[model samples]
Target: MAWSHYREMIVWQKAMDLTDEVYHLARSLPKEELYALSDQMRRAAVSIPSNIAEGYGRQTDREFRQFLSVARGSVFEVETQLEICIRQNYLSVPDAKTALALCDEVGRMLTTLSRH
Candidate 1:
């Protein structure tokens, strides 16, 4: 199957899972953070899949690859924010660990796709 059709794509599936986890995590943040970290995390989470879907729908390998690059950047952005969250004591060690691992997986997937 093509890169666009990796049904068992751990990255895509993990991205989806990460989005859900972010939503759940955001719920625990202080209400004042609603427009801050919570909002940023949600947007970053959404960007991952949005980029993938937009790229896949572009109907050209170059366009798809370009969007994948965007998605990869978002993954890094999220990872960095996650570290900040840890430093701020906003997220527990386990939560940060899991989120970072998922982001790493997405990064690896994007890199593999780029090489194709």
Candidate 2:
């Protein structure tokens, strides 16, 4: 339970990768989506790792678990938003596979971490 740094945690690292992937996908969206879907996706993607680091800083397992719960919610938010993009034809499933996979991995990691 004693992590030297949030960056040292695989879940946190994977979340960061997911955030980066989301940003890349957001950039490919149409210009009109810049302030709408793009902005929202970026925010949700950021929330994942931000909550992880914030909770890690709390230095208590209980508080950290609570933060993980929040991060997991963000994961769902990103998944929903990504699916919307696909449904709207803004992105292809092929283009989103990496981000979606990252989301799933991060979500599962949060679940396991929260249980601790």
Candidate 3:
């Protein structure tokens, strides 16, 4: 399919889903972490889709690929934060597991999309 908008991209869609999951996970954290780990994780999660959309708005594939790289970095950042949450006992292993799985899926989608 010829995607005319960023929303049409499967990576962006998956990123959106990841973002939602991250937000849900963040809400379960302690209020003391509102400005720390929770906020950082939320920002990283949001960056994936935001960068994808921004890159899609660029005129060249090169620019889009650059943005995809940024999005990929955010995916790793989210993954790392999720790990921290697990280690800190802020998030359960099962909850972190689900978020981590989404991260992997979004990362794979970003890799596939960037290749094009």
Candidate that scores best on lDDT: 2
Question: What lDDT score goes with residue 22 in model 2?
Answer: 97
Better of 1 and 2 by TM-score: 2
Assess each prediction's global lDDT (C-alpha) against the native. Answer: 0.82, 0.95, 0.92
Give the higher-lDDT candidate: 1 or 3.
3
In candidate 2, list every pair of residues with a backbone clash.
none
The best-first sequence of candidates by lDDT reads: 2, 3, 1
Q: Which stretches of candidate 3 lie over 4 Å from their true place?
A: none
User: Which pairs of residues have clashing backbones in candidate 1?
Assistant: none
Tens-digit per-residue lDDT, 1-116, candidate 1: 36546445666778888788778877877788899998998899889988887777786889988988998999998888788788888888797777788888889988898768
CA shift of 33, model 1, Å: 0.9
Residue range 28-65, candidate 3, lDDT tens digits: 99999999999999999999999999998998999989
Per-candidate TM vs. native? 0.89, 0.97, 0.95
Which scores higher on TM-score, 2 or 3? Answer: 2
